[model samples]
Target chain A: NAGVTQTPKFRILKIGQSMTLQCTQDMNHNYMYWYRQDPGMGLKLIYYSVGAGITDKGEVPNGYNVSRSTTEDFPLRLELAAPSQTSVYFCASSYEDRGLGGYTFGSGTRLTVV
Target chain B: AQSVTQLDSQVPVFEEAPVELRCNYSSSVSVYLFWYVQYPNQGLQLLLKYLSGSTLVKGINGFEAEFNKSQTSFHLRKPSVHISDTAEYFCAVSDAGGGSYIPTFGRGTSLIVHP
Candidate 1:
């Protein structure tokens, strides 16, 4: 079973191009997150959603936007792609716990901006 | 803000040899710790975690970690490693209380098991 799914496994965008990175989870988890990993670095949270119609910015939310339209979908939008935004994006979901615990991650989408 | 640090950038060990990956965290409040492994071109996989009860936690592939609250560290260890065990390991931490429990990941440690 697919826990969390991400679309466009790989994408290349022009400097001023725009695209949407799609993410969906079948776990029915209330907490969903989007993270980006740069070369030789750790995962940085871009945005997160507690549930449908609830969203918040994370550590590196600049130049990126996210919306949780439904319990299963949280799509990330990019207005103008930049080289700095080129990284592997991962979608994750976890059950809400008072003390945050574990997460199930997606296969990831590799994005490259020229 | 919660932050995690993986001391070793890379660890190289011979097959069937024991290995340890060090991790440290900094947070104002009580925190939950986790260790995740990522193989080449794949997503992170949960190896083990320390929620509250036990200090020592076991996970898949004969891996384990001990949570040292005093030192604010959770290091992963394997008695013996196989060639297939080579991968990147990440340490993460999150707040224990109310605020949105968003996880913070470390830079990651690469494990190289050579035969």
Candidate 2:
């Protein structure tokens, strides 16, 4: 399996711009998540999906949205980007609740909001 | 709600020296804990996990962690370090009590191994 794949390893967006960070997993996981990592802040969850068509907000969901249309893909959308959104974004997937097993993470996209 | 704390932000050690990365967590319900390693410019990889079995969990790259329920801590350790071991480590926790089962992650600890 290729595990999880994320596109556009790096990008710079102007204020008010919008974009989507794509994440795809080959493991057929039932759970997928989007998280942003800031310097010294660790990771803050933006959104997550338990399965296709089910999505929920996380700790820092503002300015972000997500959709899980298929078991293989979970994409995160950022609208009206701000400088505060500059961080490294990681996509992860798991077979079930994290209590069962840990998540598989993508290489991450480094976003710079100017 | 569950939360995790990584006691150290950075740890510098010489090659072949023993090292430990401390992590603590808080949760009212029973939790599953994990330690992950992230190399520079790479994604995180599981080092080990502690669910319901023994308190001691062994993981990849000759790393291990001990889960202490009383102290609510799961600290990663390696008897000897190598230059290749220089990377960032993260601790996370998830509980069954919540339907979301979303994990709480701690700020990463950077391990710097010198030659």
**Candidate 2's TM-score:** 0.97
**Against the true two-chain complex, what DockQ does each candidate achieve?**
0.62, 0.78
Candidate 2 per-residue lDDT over residues A15-110, each given as its tens digit? 999999999999989989899999888989989888999999999999898988899999999989999999999999989866367789999999
TM-score, A chain, model 1: 0.95
Question: Interface root-mean-square deviation for each candidate?
Answer: 2.0, 1.2
Each candidate's clash count: 0, 0
Cα lDDT computed for each candidate against the true fold:
0.90, 0.92
Best by TM-score: 2
TM-scores of chain A across the candidates, in order, are 0.95, 0.97
RMSD of each candidate? 1.4, 1.2
True contacts kept of each: 0.61, 0.80
Residue B113 error for model 1, in Å? Answer: 0.8
What fraction of the reference structure's interface contacts does model 1 contain?
0.61
Candidate with the greatest lDDT versus the true structure: 2
